[model samples]
Target: MGPETLLPNGIAHYLLGGLLIGAGTVVIYGATGITAGASTFLESTLSYVSGLPRFQQFRFTATRDWRVVFTLGIVLGGALYGLAFGEFGWTTDVQWWRLLGGGVLVGIGTRVGKGCTSGHGVCGVGSLSEASLLNVSVFVSIAVGTALTVQALGVSP
Candidate 1:
């Protein structure tokens, strides 16, 4: 059967996509025994607990201080790959404030949904949890609605 039903289209897409993603995650983890990504785990934990605060706890638990280092490594790796393939070159200037605003929105959304996309849409739904499906539905709906509203309002992305 097609991966759609009477349920919300976003929910169905997330459910099916999550299952496939989860399976892939299992196979990868089975072989490597290491996490493929850290954002989901970090966001989920931040959502469920109270203390110094979810974000603070996430920062400490997820070692977010090292994220900069990891990001730098990724950039360096990309640069190296580009150099090797004769693709290295300057790119467009980045808008730091815009990026920071986007990051803030993502963090807020993750907290509201009790997980990031990876957590609900990939890991949770992968396990076939009804809760994950619901969360994904809400998340996708809100995101799409917001995007459309922004566009309608002539807000530049």
Candidate 2:
């Protein structure tokens, strides 16, 4: 009645997927000695554009070559998942500007906070990084506050 009620594949499938992700993370760490971070993937991709002086300066593309491939794999895997699940056309009833603003805010937050959820929550926490712990605390706090504010404003689902 738990995951069976929530998903057709049930709890075992969820656990197996999580295990696979954890194992993959471990494999990545063992091979590269680097934590997986999605924002850095964006950085790597942005480093290609000649106009982006900041990305050009950072040289993420040069240092993170394999991660570019990893990021591309992630994108492709997501597309494959959407096709398999048949939810490719899903959308939120929000304005395009709202989505843009949110993306911008997330980019800013990742830069200021040093990393995003995959880096801090998964790999960093696994490594017992103090900064990651603090970052995660602030992240959860802000998320809770935002959810509460939205609920109070009666704009939540």
How many residue pairs clash per model? 0, 0
Q: What is the C-alpha lDDT profile of model 1 across 55-125, one tens digit per residue?
A: 55544455444444444554786788688869766553547787789788887777677666766677677
Candidate 1's C-alpha runs over 4 A off are 1-24, 28-37, 40-94
Could you say which candidate leads in TM-score? Answer: 2
lDDT of each: 0.63, 0.81
Task: Report model 1's TM-score to 2 decimal places.
Answer: 0.50
Model 2 per-residue lDDT tens digits across residues 100-130 = 9989998899999999988898888888999
Error of 1 at 4 (Å): 22
Minimum summed lDDT over a 10-residue window in model 1 is located at 34-43
